[model samples]
Target: MTDEEVTEQVREDAEEQAEDAEAETETEDHLGPTSTKLVAEVATQDANLATELEGHLAQLEADREEARERADELESKLKRKQADFQNYKKRAKKRQEQMKDRATEDLVENLLDVRDNLVRAVEDDHENVESLKEGVEMTLKELDRVFEGENVEAIDPDPGTETDPQRHEVMMQVESDQPEGTVADVYQPGYEMGEKVLRAAQVTVSDGE
Candidate 1:
């Protein structure tokens, strides 16, 4: 219990307290710096992920743009083909009409000489009656043969037969014992070529009074 012993004990107590405070400060420093570094690294990793997502999104947009362009190109091609087909159809229809016109022209050309000969014989100014009559008859036969070959038929309605306006051009009206609209007499013959009419027959119609 001397003063030296008391002072040594106090020194030992003070040194123990200093050691505890230093240990606590060291722990706080280590934890604070390491946690801050860890937080920064996590933020950097999140930034990298965001950059990758942005790149993927840009790639998707580019792909969509290319797809749209391809679709537009296909639509243009379809329109062009459709336009070409329309033009082709128009040309084909025009060609058919032209061919029909050409055929009609050839037919008229071939009949011109026969028509002229008939005209010459019909003038009635020549003195030779018998030869002119024979020439006229021969020309008529040639015309009939031509008409027959072309499927032209003469309409000759019989007495008391039903009259039709399609084949007969009424020339006269007669009062008779026959039924209404009956053909009484046919004055001129009508000619037909297939389903088409070349001429209408002149006829007299009879109606019961």
Candidate 2:
């Protein structure tokens, strides 16, 4: 075939192809407005799904932040509890130590008055008999000063005061006109230091009843 004839045939084929494509497009358009609206609706639904997914992600992030804050609060409370327990233990230990020291001091205080009596007895003796007594008296006085410095008081019960079982011990009850339940005489003095009572006085109670 001639070149011009071949060229013309190719052109005709291309025109028919274009016409077929246009016909197919026209068929889709003829399906009506429902087809166009459906496609637009599908796009709108996709947008809505994207928005809902983003909202869920935001909610999950908020929940995670709240959980973290709660964990911090719990951790703070635990630390405070530990500190308070430590402080309480320290206070208890200090109180126990103070009680033990008080007990030891009471023992020392009770013996001070006895030592003083022995010193006075020997101090009134002659020089040859006084050397040993003088040495003992000095030692006893020094021991008493040590007790006084530690706030240990030697309690000597007076006869006029009403007898209390906590502070006085009755050795013998004798008939008298003093009172029915009062201490008649203090045989041995009691000792008290601060708020603690070391020993009760050995006393004779009046049997006025």
Candidate 3:
């Protein structure tokens, strides 16, 4: 080949090499560095997601533990409350029984005094009937005072009063000048405290006049 031909071929080969170098630089810029940065970003995002997930799991566990502790505390309180209620019930029952026993003892003690007075009156050797009557009357007066102090009332209705079934017991029907169904006579007086009737008054209800 001539010199001109060799020089022209060499120039064409140099231009082709330059174009290949530019294409290689563009491919490296688009694929190598950009791809490496995208991969690093994906790895960082994955790590962050893992960290957030661990935090959520830990919080859930802590919440579960707190709930269990609260439940235990409430259970303990419930047990204590139940025990207190049972103890209160027992105390109230015992107190009620004690009050009843005390009331019965007081009543018996008062009745014993009356019994002693009667025994003394009976055992006295005074042969005079008037003296015996006076002793008995005085004893009765003392008993009446005791009854009054103890809030005991005598049920001694008048003979002309209307017979009350609630406070009076009719022994027998009797003919009298009073109205029918009226108290003709009181056989025995009753004693009562408050609204309680110890015994009803014994009376004879009058028939028609």
Per-candidate TM equals 0.59, 0.54, 0.60
Residues 64-128 of candidate 2 have per-residue lDDT tens digits of 99999999999999999999999999999999999998877776677766677666766655667
Query: Using alpha carbons, what is the TM-score of model 3?
Result: 0.60
> For model 3, how does the per-residue alpha-carbon lDDT over 1-209 read when each residue is reduced to its tens digit?
99999999999999999999999999988899888999999999999999999999999999999999999999999999999999999999999999999988887787777778788899988789998898788788878877887789999999779988889999998998878899999999987899998999999988976
> Who is ahead in lDDT, 1 or 2?
1
Candidates' lDDT values, in order? Answer: 0.87, 0.83, 0.91
* TM-score between candidate 2 and the true structure: 0.54
Clash numbers, per candidate: 0, 0, 0
Stretches of model 1 off by over 4 angstroms after superposition: 1-63, 119-128
- Count backbone clashes in candidate 3: 0
lDDT of 3 at 102: 92
Candidate 1 C-alpha lDDT tens digits along 63-163: 99999999999999999999999999999999999999997886777577679879888875877889898878878887777667667799888878887
Task: Rank candidates by lDDT, best first.
Answer: 3, 1, 2
